[model samples]
Target: MSDTTATPTRPVNWTAISITAAVVMGGILAALLAVAPRDDGGIAWFDPMIPGGWMAWTLPVAIFFWCIASLLVTFTILAIRFPETPRVGVLRIETTRGDRLFISLLGSAFICLVWLFFAGLPVWGALALCLVYAAAVFRWV
Candidate 1:
């Protein structure tokens, strides 16, 4: 008699997954930019709402690109160097990669909103806060 229990298997190659995710994110960004509406001045339609500064000229796109790039780099690094790092969950519950990503994105949005509501200009401050939030989420949720 043969016992039939399924055993879990690790992915054969995390590097490929990381590279694929980066390429897919880049493609999505490119597609969005390609179809996004522009104003007469060649700026994005939402440029007026974005804060102005040396690096804020292309605010939304810059932030979006930065976030994606950060995620890609982080995933690559984690996959290559810290594949065994344990992921913490919300309320001490077990969490997966998707959960952590969701928490990070949500935290970032909250940070941006709080910054917009209470503070103005120099979004770097908010970015710093968001980075801390992301770190906390990854570490403890």
Candidate 2:
């Protein structure tokens, strides 16, 4: 008898991947652009003729990137440590490495948005968010 352990087929979910990439990239870009604003102790108006103004824009992007990195590392660690767990929802999830990555990146964006809504936020916010995300992902996904 011939061995018949065929490779499992992957779902053709290009749309999901595309949307994920677009949202993540867009958020990062917006954040970077809003990173810095030059102020020389004077009232400065919007001037397209300025040079360093572009630097201010990089802040948001930097924060977004930082969030992503923080989430990725945090989730990876948790997923390995905890292994698989049942969630409060109607599904039991096995924490795969790929799932960990996806959840981390996506959840990081949401956490960053929430932080932004509550005035000036810090990198710690992102770190904390990653921790919560790791738990939630372990439970749910």
The best candidate in terms of TM-score: 1
Task: Report the lDDT tens digits of candidate 2 across residue range 1-141.
Answer: 999999999765655655665677667655544534446953233433235555543444455566666566555555555565533342455446556567666787788787777745566866687788867775566
Computed on alpha carbons, the lDDT of every model, listed in order, comes to 0.70, 0.59
Model 1, residue 14: what's the lDDT?
65
lDDT per residue (tens digit) for residues 40-97 in model 1: 8574756633355455335476557666676766766675666554555656766765
Candidate 2, run of 10 with poorest lDDT: 42-51
Which window of ten consecutive residues has the lowest lDDT sum in model 1? Answer: 48-57
Against the hidden true structure, what lDDT does model 1 obtain? 0.70
TM, every model: 0.50, 0.35
